[model samples]
Target chain A: MSARILLVEDDEKLGRQIVEHLTEAGLEASWLRDGGTALGLAPQNWALLILDLMLPGAHGLDVLKRWRSQCDVPVLVLSAKQDASVKVRALELGADDYMTKPFWPEELVARVQARLRRPVLARADRVECGAIALDVAARRVFVGGAEVELTKVEFELLQALAMRPGAAIARSWLVQNVLPPERDGTERTLDVHVSRLRKKLGTAGAQLTTVWGIGYKLKSEDVA
Target chain B: MRLATRLALTLLVTALPLTVGLVFLRERAARSAELDALVDYARGRMESGGREACEDAPEIFQDPPFRLPGDRRFGGPAPRDPLGLGRGPGGPGPDGPNAPAGAGGARPLRGRGPDFQQPPGRAEPAGPAAARFELWAYNPDFRSDNPAAPALEPALRAALERGAVLASGTFELPGRNGLPPRGGLQAVLRMAWTDGPCAIVLARRIDLPAEGSLLLARFGLPALLATLLVLVTLFAFLPFVRRVRALTAGVRRSAASGYVDPVGASGSDELTELGRAFDTAGAQVREQIERLERRERSLRAFVENTTHDVMLPLTVLQGHLVALERRAAANEVPDPSRVREAQEEAHYLGALLENLGAAARLEADELPIERHRMSLNRLIERAVGRQTTIARGKGVELVHALPGEEVEVEADVTLFERAVSNLVHNAVRYGREGGHVAVVLEVEGDEFVVRVLDDGPGVSDEELARLHERSYRTESARRRHPTGTGLGLSIAKEVCERHGFGFQLRRAEVGGLEAILRGPRAKPGGGNRSTA
Candidate 1:
């Protein structure tokens, strides 16, 4: 079955073009002319949400946040404003990724594919890297089948690094991914949480090795 | 005080003395005329009295007894004891020729009364005749010891005989017993009877006439002194008044006009000095105002260009990105190659926007770059490493030729990296396929030189001349490359300028473009490397 995406945009021509492109890319896109319809239809049966920041009825950021509060559907924001603050703000508001306007159609498709791929692992209910096993639905962690008590932030930080195992995840990217939507904290706060997670996980945490001048990356037992 | 007032003062000073002198001379003439009239009246009265007295009686040698109020008779003869007009008859009376009673009696006359007095009537009294008026006359003829006596008696006798009216004349008088020497005498002789030959002679000392000449002499000095005082006083006071007035006028004019006349030109004085000072102050104020105006205009131009020209292009670029993204989402997969081309365009557009924003910030003096001490050799290596893929993709050999030693510089790492990145990007874009691009760093004296030389279609002379101008891309660069913001060189230039470094673009020896950036060395006398 094709993934369903709710495409929210105010510009009629741009909306039609986006819908056509997504359909051709093998994704069923439900085009909505405003943020209101997109938000209303988001929980019904959509795989992901593609939102334009300049939207009618409700702002894209507001819609993204409201939908995020109710469900865990991935949201990808398309913004025309080139200011870095806007991109950073959209990403912080539970958006999986943000693409500035005038971006390549292929790049947008790539980001959407990446976002959709994220949930397939999520449905497995548990992920294991070396001795560490994270039970997704239960929000619990285990080291070699021995349950370990982990704080919510520490669990999220480990999960974010573990998801892209062997690839260096920049600290900024981890902060954007791991932090909760409404949590107001700096990127350094993420480092402290990572350190705490390392302590709690003990031997299982050793797989989370820091890549100097880049970021943190998790190594599987086979690579170790 | 103005020039007019000063001029008026000067005129008044000169006219004042002349006016006073004219008035003084008028008064002196009036006084002298009055004195001359009084003298004439006295002489007339004496002549008339002598004639009247002589005509009244002749041969009244017994000395007619005559009394006139305020008059004492003397000269010629003295009456007997009954009249007591002269000293006793043989004791120097007119009857005794040798006695010369008139001389003795003249002394009594001198002490008797005032010379003239205003009477009640307008008509004055005539002198008494010898017959009706008592006469005391003196004859110095018998006094042989007196030299002036002999000439005086004959002159008096001749006056008495010839005269119908005796006129006053001056003659010499001789001094007698116990009298001081007398050199001159004034005498008049008249007949007592018209028919008779009898005569009476009256004589007085001539020394008294000299007193009238002395009176005129006494007034001359004071008159001259008054004229000199007026002249001196006027001359001394006039210049001060003129100077004060001129100074006041100069101050008023300067205040009114808001500018001062140059000194010495106005007038050669202290006021001229004051004018020069004011003029200097005015010139300074004008110069400062001009400088402020120039600065304001420059600031205004900077703001206008950033807002209107720069922001418009950035907005357009963002819109283009949005359009491109929407096309790719509908995975019709129309053409994968076209999609890749569009993606590359979007990337270039983003870069262009960022560089434009950075350039604006630099022009507005708002860009903030963090400084760090980094080795130039390491910086060049990193920049080269990033550009290696692109250079190889273009089939261009990228080479870094440098010495082994470290070349440290104090700089903003990010901005400096960007600047070097732009230079390499330009080299790869314009370099001929399979051609070589070289980055060479060398230490010359106190400076570190980084030269980027590429074998490409080089810029023309005109393009090289204006290479650093914002948004000014050469025709050759535009023709050779399909993609560029035309702002790379400008941004690089701004960065180099901000860091106090010298940037130049010239024709290379390899017949391609050679760009150079020279900056002050971080260490003194430290041998640094040449990096390509």
Candidate 2:
């Protein structure tokens, strides 16, 4: 199946080249040279939309806001500016992801392919990350095949890491979001919880990996 | 306190004492003048009237008036006044030799019994009359015959002994201060009696009002003067107070506006001078703010120009790389010209990014450089290697040589490489088409010099001098590289400065610009001799 992608960009050369990249990656892509045409995009007709913020007519964010209220197409917002607030504002307006401009053209094609191939998020009773499995409704964790008992803090920490299996979560984020406020949610305490969870997972403990300077990622060696 | 009120109080404080003192002093002077006038009046009355009375009744001069045998007042409280001041020295003028004693017995009583105080133009009889002084007579022996006479006053005795015509003295009556006016003066005069030179005297007490009341009464005028003076001065200082108040408000307003407005000054006075000073200071502050704004504008322009310069080439190069990647993935040979163009753009972008990154890091100066003893030979090799593909794409032959020995210098290796790379890039980019670009690293005259030299079409002598100035570019430079950000040389200079090295540009005899980085003398290692 050919993944249909939409691109809104004003820079003629960059837009043309991005189209070539997406096409060479085996995706059917269409490009719009003006932001004004971005408003008419029907999410059902496209798998993903790559939007550029600095455009010739209507602003990219306005298009994003309008399209998002009516549709659920994944959009990757693009900008040449390195300003963080602009990125934050784009994210807040319902952009699924972002890429700062002047990136390798191959990287954009890869991001587009990855975005199209992403699994849709849905509520499920069972969650699996490599050798670890979670029974969400029962709040139970199983390593390989046998169940491993964990404390409340340890269980929450494992759940946070296993939710996004290979992506590294920042230590500060774990301290603020995953750790209970009453427990000393400092990074030092987080390390203790993670280590305890790793130990308790026993044979599949290798999947609970510590990402240095960040928090942790749960990935079994054979999963990739 | 308010300034006006404080100043008025000062006026009151200073003027009141002086006013009171002046009033008391003036009152005292007037009182003494009146006392002297009373004494003179006593002297005149004795000379004009009392002298004649004494001669007409010479028996009354005998210290006791000779009374007739049937006289009613034969032994009255007469001639026995203990302290010898007349019955009342300042009493009625009739308290003297009785007319009955003078005329009823031995002598013919004349209207001259003792009409001493008779008015100057009146032919009055020897009857009751008002007197300002007491009248008495003295014998040649300094004796008084009047019943009310003081007994032979010392002033009269002294006059008798000296044979002077007249004498006068002042005395405080013993018992008169409370019920009556205090103090009196007596005057004695020598007169021609029918028998001998008899002396007649006049005495009077000077009635002066109570000193406390006199001084208190005089106080009103000086107090009024002082009050009036304070009022006048307060009014006079009104303008001064007003100007100072306005000055305070003006300063606060100027400060509130960030000193953008000038403080107002109108009149030529101290307060105006103060206002002018504030204005000058405020103007300086405004000028500094404007200067900062100008600098910020230039900085912003620098960022915009840099962004435009770097982005266009960056976008085009990314397209080329993607095309090449796709062609390789499809197992097709990439076009050589496109490959060469991509390499050239990559070299250009890499050098520009290095220069910009170094410039930014140098400005922040947060992380101190980690300088290791590194080889300058390695630095030159990398710089030439990085630019070799771009040089080849332009048909330029790039030649580089380092000393046969390892030439080591203490430097942060990364920053030093960026500096050397920019020099090589500029030479390759701006040198004449297909011209030779040579980079040499060698020790010359105790310093290690890294040189990037190119062929003709370099900067002129005048332009070479200006190359040290930040963001300076020549006309030929603009033609060769139209999108130059003009930051490469300045960044190189900053990096060199951070390493305590010298950077210079010169026109070589070979007819091209030579960029030089002078470093410390190379240290020999591995038994290789550094070029001397």
Candidate 3:
């Protein structure tokens, strides 16, 4: 089935142009001008949310926050203001990516497609790397067939790094993925949690080696 | 206080006391002189009587009718001539055997009864009114023989013995021997007689002068009235002085503090004039400040609006250029024609943004230029290079007929580049589509001239006159190519003005528009550095 997308924009001409482009790109996209209308729609039905920062009823940042509160749908924000702070703010508030205005139609479509494709390949409800089996659907984990207690955030950190097994992810990407937008957790918090996770997983956690100048990556041999 | 009021107050304060004191002193001197005159009159009368007693003894004996014992009138014993009678064994006797006896066998005087008294040794009676005398005189001899006479005080006697005249002072005479008590004026006249120097003091009570008494009676009331008048005048004038001083100080303070004009009028005086001047000056300053502030605010608003509007278009243009560059790089055999078109558009975009920025800076007076000596030939060569690609694309040739030697002139590098670039761009836009354009740089005497010659249709006189006006595009040029914002010549003109160069537009030798930039040559021995 075609993926369901929500496009929120205020300008009628720009919004119509974007919708036509997305439809041609083979995505089932619906256009909403106001944030209230987009918020009323059920999040379970939509695969991706394309938001414009300068909306009428509510700001795109607020809409993205409200959407993330109810569902885990990925969000892409479009803005006319090209300042770097605006892009960082939208990304911090649960948006998966940001694009400045007067952008190419193809690039906008590509970014939206990337956000939509993220959940399917997000790892089978639970992921296993080395002797560590993370049951994401059940919110539990096992280290070498022995049950291990993992906090929600600790599991999220392991899951984010484990998704790209054997590949180093930047520290910034891990913070963006594992922490809520309003949380004031630091890089030290991530390190402390990783250390705790190492103690819990024992030999399995040892397989999570640190990559200098980069971030931690799981070893292929450790995956079962 | 006002200067005038203060001056008047000072004059009044000093003049009032001096004038009143002068008047009081004059009146006191006049009254004292009058008293002295009265004393002199009494002294003259006493001195005349003393002279007669000392010079003539018979004058005292034969002055009036005598009631004596042998006067051939009343069958009494002949009266002894006391003046002719010699001193007896002891002294002169008060009553002798030949002494004139009146009723009751008492001695009588020549003038009247013996009871008619005289101031002892001073026997002369100048007037017929001897009873009117209030004088009292005493000698020890007279007082001892005449038991009815009163004696003088020892203090008075001692003062008389010292040859002091007018020794008598104000005192009450005791009423004795049937005399009435009276207040008197006193005088002591010293006379040199046969008995030697003696003081005949006479006490007479004179009535006080009416004028002196009246003056004394009114002195307190007039002084009290004068004091009250002074107080009333001061009380009335003090508020005026205080109010005037406050107004003066307020005006002075306002003048000292920046541009705060004094409020309200302070009477119709010099202070009012000063206040008016202050108001005028303050108004002028306020007006100037307000005008400057308004200019600054408008300039800021213009800058903000220009930046906002221009940056939006610039951002879109940049994105387009980036995409075009990506496409050009990806092609195995990049289409040179398309690449040239893209680059031209990008160049146009960059030039447009630069001109807008420069115009905004000029309007805001924020851009400062750095000037240096530059070779005009090199500057022209660089300007030609900027348009070489476009000229080649259009199948046009750009010829540089510059002198072999450098022609140095003073100019800012970036501004000179922009000016030359604008001229080249204008020539490329309006020149014949495939015609040749020649740039020439040469020095003539003290001037360096740069000329851009095109082969397009030449402009009319009117068009050439208004050529450098901002956004003034020729009708033919706009119809043929409407891409430019028509600010090239205007910007070039501004740069020339900034560098103190002269700009002239005329028909080219090759039958198109020609722009000439001329200015003073750099000093000899100066290195020619490229400004652009």
Candidate 4:
């Protein structure tokens, strides 16, 4: 069954365009133009919600705050506001993702797909891909049944990407979590660490691809 | 440590040295006074009668002219001092034969005050009483010739050898009646006669049994005083400690409540001043929080309004692109008006983006403005070129007037361009259809001026003055574009203020609003572009 998505947006053209994009990506999407009516609907029935702020009847944050108390459904906030505080507020209110307006439909659909895909590679103590095997609980990794030594930071960076294989992890997020505070987290340093990690991984490093302006993605397809 | 505990500990700890020091000083003073009185008694006895007895008759000099311990010839105790020099300060009580005068005066005296004369039928215990003092004599060669004399200490003999006329020492004597050994004090004195000098020794014993009684007498009062001092300080210090704790709790409460709670301090002390200082500081912190909160509220409003304004044109631009994509997908001819509409929407979107960037850069305020020589001539021409599409979309003629020579200002080029763009966009977006907007760049005296004049329906005189308030839109502006951000002109003003430039908004002679930016012209050859 195709996954169903709920959209709460007041703009006519943008809402239609988003619905078409999701439909073209083979997802069933239901659109709600009024925030008031959308508040009455059960969010649990849908696989995901693409909620827009600045609605007519009710603000998107209020709706998100109310729904968060009763359900664990994922919420993707689509707002045109560029202020950092507003995005923080939306995420703090329990939004799974926050995308600004004037976004390419491909980014929206790709982000939506990434949000819907639960991490499958590292669900248990041991994760076995084609060539790389990870002992997540032990914080160790192996290539082709041979132990591969990795630094703590390098292991964390690989584990973060490997958890969601082929999905880009943000450089900002990686800098905040993977790097030690003593590293200072400059982008240059991050690049240096990544290059060192690739060198350490040897030929299996081919699976790690830089997503250009975004960040790194660990592809399971080329790991073998 | 807690305030009250710290205070209690400090008070108790500080009181210890004082108590110990005071007690030590009291003990030293009491012992010294007792020693002085004992010495005085011993010396007086030896100097008056003992020395004369040795000088007049050396045969009975050891016993002071035929007087024994309980002799009764001189009377019950001994010869009384006619000059009253025997009694000394801090002497034993009046019940004893020789009591202290004044300091230990007015005792029973035991009838020995007027020189040892026996009363009729009196049977006084003279053994212990007369044992207090023992007198002996040493010849000029330092020998005690009497066979029954107590041994003369070598230290006293040496003192005599060194030419001292009198010397005294205390010693332990055999106790009578099986009591513990008694203390004995002895003194030696020298007498100069026709023949030679005879050393006379006078001695008095310090009472051991009476020591317990003396301890109570000398130490009891001061002990009580020290106890009182410590108790009073600890109790008095309690209030101060309690007040400090209360003040701390009040400060914690204020911080927990966003520095809004007052300490409600009372009393007139240093602690009260401290509490008032905390309250004052808390009030200032509360004011700062409120100000930050107010700024945050306005910033939020501006962001939302900008998003709405940008989104409207953005949606139009996207819709046109989507339509064009659809027409091309089906191999159909494109509509020129729709493409033009898309171009105009794109132009407005670019201007909106520049405004948003300026607003964001202005808000964060971390990056410093890099100054460079910016030509207003090119800046105005670029702004007009950018806004011409939007102006044409609104059926307004966009025009400009440049100075004959290139006019330059020292400013951050990006910020200056954005500010100019915002002004031009504001004039064009708000101007009336079929009316023209003018952009003029010229140098007036020492300042370079840029004017954006429009032929739109002007705002009220009251609203015109407040046109630069953040997120504040006039009634006509709201009516014309219900989703207007009201951020463009305000951001332009902020850029001007940041550059120390003067910005003005007034009614134009062409029946519209006139916006002006006045800045100091750059010095010749001063603005070199930095590689950084």
Q: Individual DockQ of the candidates? A: 0.02, 0.01, 0.01, 0.01
C-alpha lDDT of residue B476 in model 2: 19
Deviation (Å) of A13 in candidate 4 = 29
- Tens-digit lDDT track of model 1 for B1-532: 6645565566567656655675577555643432232223223323434333333432221122233342445333332333222123223334432222334433322212222221211111222111112123332221222122233355545655564345344444456565444343244544333233223344332231232344344445554665576567657767756665665676566556544342122666665666666567655755666656655654565455444554544555565555556666774444544443343344444545545455544544444554454568656765565556556656787765443245777665546756776787677666778887777766666778887878788878777876755442222222324332246676777788778889888888777788899998677344321111
Query: Where does candidate 2 stray beyond 4 Å?
Result: A1-224, B1-222, B228-287, B325-340, B353-399, B404-419, B428-437, B454-532
Which parts of model 1 are misplaced by more than 4 Å? A1-224, B1-279, B324-440, B444-446, B453-512, B519-532
Give TM per candidate: 0.31, 0.35, 0.38, 0.46
TM-score of chain A of 2: 0.64
lDDT of 4 by residue, B1-532 (tens): 9766776677668766776777688666644444444455545544544444455544444432232234322211332333232222222333443322232222222222123322211222232122233345556676655544566778987897787866666677677667677664455555543133345554444344442354455456656776787678778877877787788898888889887778878999888898899889888888878767866865775677577777788888899999999999999998877886797676667666766666656765545665665556656765666676667767887766554355778776567777887888878877777887877776777788888888788767777755655431332212334223256777788889889999888888767888899989887567552211
- The window of 10 residues in a row where model 4 chain B has the poorest summed lDDT is B120-129
Candidate 4 lDDT at B200 equals 50
TM-scores, chain B, all models? 0.37, 0.43, 0.47, 0.58
Tens-place lDDT per residue, model 3, A1-224, is 58988889989999999999999999998989998777666776788888898878787778887888898787777876624346546655666655545455665775676456533353488787778877878888888788898888888878777666665554545665686658887776777877888787788877786653235666646632
> What is the alpha-carbon interface RMSD for each candidate?
15.0, 21.5, 23.2, 19.2
Residue-wise lDDT of candidate 2 within A1-224, one digit each (tens)? Answer: 79889999998888899999888888899999887788776766888999999887799989989889988889888876644356556766778767654455655775676578664556667888778889888999987788999888888788777766665556666787788898666888888888888789886787877653234677735342
Q: In terms of lDDT, which candidate is stronger, 2 or 3?
A: 2
